[model samples]
Target: SAAELLGDPAAYESMSQAANPYGDGRASHRIAEVLLHHFRGKPRPADWGGHA
Candidate 1:
């Protein structure tokens, strides 16, 4: 895989620029949104962190 990526500059660039599927350092925001919605009856955020 490393050699294949090295041999293809476009592939390497695309992989390097791709968004991380794991997260974007906003786990706290998402968690807080869920907790507030559950406990305080606040409206859930549009993002909803991820899928149900």
Candidate 2:
């Protein structure tokens, strides 16, 4: 299935620049922030740790 999907040249290019359904490539940063908020028991600002 993976090979079939990637084998289509047009499909490959289309998928490359597709908008991320999640929070872009900054998902890890967002996840870390949520963890920190839960552990610290407070609403931390977006800039709490650093830039995403």
Candidate 3:
């Protein structure tokens, strides 16, 4: 759709993709670990940091 909007079929080739700057898409998991329990009554993993 971006390429179509730009009217340049080659535009897609120039697009750049990168990792999510905020986190590794585990925000919901992190929130659940804090506000809710994942496995009903287990402790969170030792390394539960958001991202690198």
Candidate 4:
């Protein structure tokens, strides 16, 4: 499978450039803010400035 995929330039490029479904690995930051707000009454930080 790996060799087949690598051999096809178009397929490899398509897969390499595809958008990631998960939002830029900032999920932990949001989760931390939520937990802090819930447990310590701290204000949640401003929205993470990231592309949708």
Candidate 5:
């Protein structure tokens, strides 16, 4: 059963310390940036556009 599998202390500890094969928190930020870019386009502030 699922509960039995998770109930083992050794298994739980191993799972907790396991590294995420996909990504970490940075993936979440990247996803948000892509969504924002899709909806709002690139952000070019006025300060950055002024160049002589």
Candidate 6:
């Protein structure tokens, strides 16, 4: 089934490289904001996972 998804080279490449169903790993602040504002009903924290 997984190999079948690779049959179309272009589609496979795009799918393989595209964003996953989960949130993007690169946007910690954005993800944190979403989690806080939407899910937790809390304010967006100042750090948002970028701590020293």
The C-alpha TM-scores of every prediction are 0.48, 0.38, 0.36, 0.47, 0.39, 0.31
Q: Tell me the spans in candidate 3 whose CA falls farther than 4 Å from its real position.
A: 4-17, 36-40, 50-52
Clashes of each: 0, 0, 0, 0, 0, 0
Candidate 2 pairs with clashing backbones: none
For all candidates in order, the CA lDDT equals 0.81, 0.69, 0.60, 0.81, 0.61, 0.67
Range of the 10 consecutive residues with the lowest summed lDDT in candidate 2: 43-52
Query: What TM-score, to 2 decimals, does candidate 2 have?
Result: 0.38
lDDT of 2: 0.69
1-52, model 6: which lDDT tens digit per residue? Answer: 5776767787778777876666556577676687887787887555544422
> For residues 14-43, could you state the per-residue lDDT of candidate 5 as single tens digits?
776788766564656666676677788965
Model 1 residue pairs with clashes: none
Which stretches of model 6 miss by more than 4 angstroms?
1-4, 23-52
Writing each residue's lDDT as its tens digit, candidate 2 over 1-52 gives 5795678888778877677655356767777888888898768747543332
Pairs clashing within candidate 4? none
| Best of the candidates, TM-score | 1
lDDT of 1 by residue, 1-52 (tens): 9997999999999988878877677889888998999999999777643522
lDDT winner, 1 or 5: 1
Provide the RMSD of all predictions against the true structure, rounded to 1 decimal.
Answer: 4.9, 6.2, 4.8, 3.9, 11.1, 8.6
By TM-score rank, best first, the candidates go 1, 4, 5, 2, 3, 6
lDDT, model 5, position 13: 78
Question: lDDT: which candidate is best?
Answer: 1
Point out the higher-scoring one by TM-score: 2 or 4: 4
lDDT tens string, model 3, 1-52? 7647478646644543444566667767667776545657667545664453
